[model samples]
Target chain A: MLTYPKTELNKVKRGTKRAVYDVEQINHILDAGFIGFIGCNYNGKTITLPMAYGRIDNKVYLHGSLKNRMLLALIAAKEASMTVMHLDGLVLARSGLHHSVNYRSATLFASVRKVEDPEEKKTALKCVVDHMIPDRWETLRPMNTKELNATLVLEMEIQSASAKIRDEGVVDEKSDLELPIWAGIVPLKQVAKLPVRDALLPKQLKTPKHVVTYYKKNKT
Target chain B: MLTYPKTELNKVKRGTKRAVYDVEQINHILDAGFIGFIGCNYNGKTITLPMAYGRIDNKVYLHGSLKNRMLLALIAAKEASMTVMHLDGLVLARSGLHHSVNYRSATLFASVRKVEDPEEKKTALKCVVDHMIPDRWETLRPMNTKELNATLVLEMEIQSASAKIRDEGVVDEKSDLELPIWAGIVPLKQVAKLPVRDALLPKQLKTPKHVVTYYKKNKT
Candidate 1:
């Protein structure tokens, strides 16, 4: 076993590419992401949507109008699979044949239940807010009864899951290495700029330092 | 009734937030993502994983080692639902109550299936390569039979879907306008850096500008 056995996905034989299995590495990838692509089937059509979500203690918490048909169907099905991702960079191989992407991603398989409990729902909301900005939940107003009733929270109990990744760059076959082609990685990054408050906000309101530091993410 | 009716979800009522409805816009969001988050249920233990994927026309293509249990489950399910996402930026509101994120996201319903045809799988790979780097596909070498066989191709048909977004900063109720708060949108972006070739790649290889100038996605 390697020093990082938990992070390896395929241990048997990786005929082509090696998969990452480290949970720490995976968590790093998740925190770096701001959104996730939601995939599911309805009336026989496969539809994909990008949505906002949060990760807490290994489980995923998502909220939208309870009326979201896709969320309804998946929760109704009681079972769904979601793919969350962080695109690290683009892989450039010597030959177009070997071209690929350098990224870190994950897939979750779990049973979902619509969160109905008032306290649990509040906890879930706090998880999301804290995920967006660490410890921001305590600094903001707690969910009033009205706001809680207005939204539906769904909890996906993550069961069996796996993460696959293609990092580094093209490893041309021994003979193909001689080909004259640029081969390497083109990095990708997500950056958050300075906070912009709402136009209608009270005149006395000012930006918080955490809000400013929360935006430390930027392209290198 | 609103100028941006498509932005609102259909299930939302008059008092709810305004959401976009154009499915085409939703598809555009799908194309913008580099990775995905998968939620699934297996053996009752819920788990989530991130993955790399490509959007070609109305289909989403995701591949990995066929031996992967999670992917096998998707093919086995034949039809399931998932969410694909790209987070554009964070929206900072003046009032903590009105705080929200500025994001472009889409949610979809889909039936998952494994791509069987060899030519089709090859094409999917090409599409994936192109999706990640645009025109760079035409510049690369063709995939040989072995490379094609090593990868597992799963295709999801993009049928009925919805794209929703909140692009601006804080939207406080009219009365909240008098509150003194800094409010505006903090822009977010996905950027690419100069390409780096592999250490062993031929020295004659030169970087192509197209590899660097493809469409930039706004991801979380």
Candidate 2:
């Protein structure tokens, strides 16, 4: 299995047991979610913002308006990091100190650059939209020249990455196990409800096959 | 309504219509979620990590092992920022450019300091645990002196804050309305399953009232 080299930047310090450096595992964590918290330095303080992203191989794509401050800062700095997490469950323990959460999280450090080539930019945009919902870009209206010009696309070539996963039952002190308090795991899931069609659409138009498939796979 | 003053640090530049500065609205966004993405500078590169947080008025609390590198970085910086977001739905549009998510998100810039007072430290820790689930701290075994001392608690006093909310339906270009593509919202929700009791717990001990209440409120 391919794994990232543990550097000072991507090493997990506090929870060494939960730390993961394998590339496949980190990619799995990233592919499970579409939104990522992107960190950038702004006015001497680091700030994070959520953005939709897509991954192909070792590169992640991000797009926004040309005037986006955070994206501009990233390009100026030439390096960036994004983190994604999925909360699986809540771990309740007999003691307050032992309480924890079941989660899988990944952080990627990458070099940032603008996607200037038109064809590459278009492919990146499609990758991003398709990442949100598989086969979504095929049915959508194609981007016009004006729209394409106004958009800013960024390419992040991942340099180093790490992941952490905790998927276990409660762990409490030996003495606290016999306490009268209840303890267990409460599993959490992000599910989808029935789709609501836009009022502008014709009543006769039906939901597409991809939409139905996504709903079936994601619904509670 | 009380609103945070517009400043360069917390200003929302792109989506002016979705920007919210009202204190009550921002607090509502903060209270709806427990995990926040905290940004910190590491070796000249900004990194974001998910951390459980609790908010009391304008102050946010975070705790971890005393040796946590991220916590120590925040203390060294003396100022930090956190971003919390709740994804509400997937907004599929006829044009890929219009595709977006219905969400409520808040970002806070704060001055950070380590909590040294014993009483305040205990209170902050309780707040952090209780924020995960209401009334959880009261039922769990209290923390011992060793545990308390081994923990590092940081209090972030909010200096500026801003929120963005988008709860409306699909907004597509007028020309794309005639297209046959599917357009609408797929509502997303984070829900809890039935609690699983720890194997060590006596079969006689029942799930607590707070856990049941939390489940009832969050279940699909």
Best by TM-score: 2
Candidate no. 1 TM-score:
0.74
Question: What's the residue-level lDDT of B219 in candidate 1?
Answer: 31
Tell me the TM-score of chain B in each candidate.
Answer: 0.82, 0.99
| Total clashing pairs for each candidate | 96, 0
Q: Please compute and give the TM-score of the first chain of candidate 1 against the native first chain.
A: 0.83
**CAPRI-style docking class of model 2 based on DockQ:** high
The local distance difference test score of each candidate is 0.62, 0.93
The prediction achieving the highest DockQ against the true structure is 2
TM-score each candidate.
0.74, 0.99
Name the 10 consecutive residues with the lowest summed lDDT in model 2 chain A: A39-48
lDDT by residue (tens digit), candidate 1, B23-43: 567666777765555544445
Question: True contacts preserved, each candidate?
Answer: 0.62, 0.89
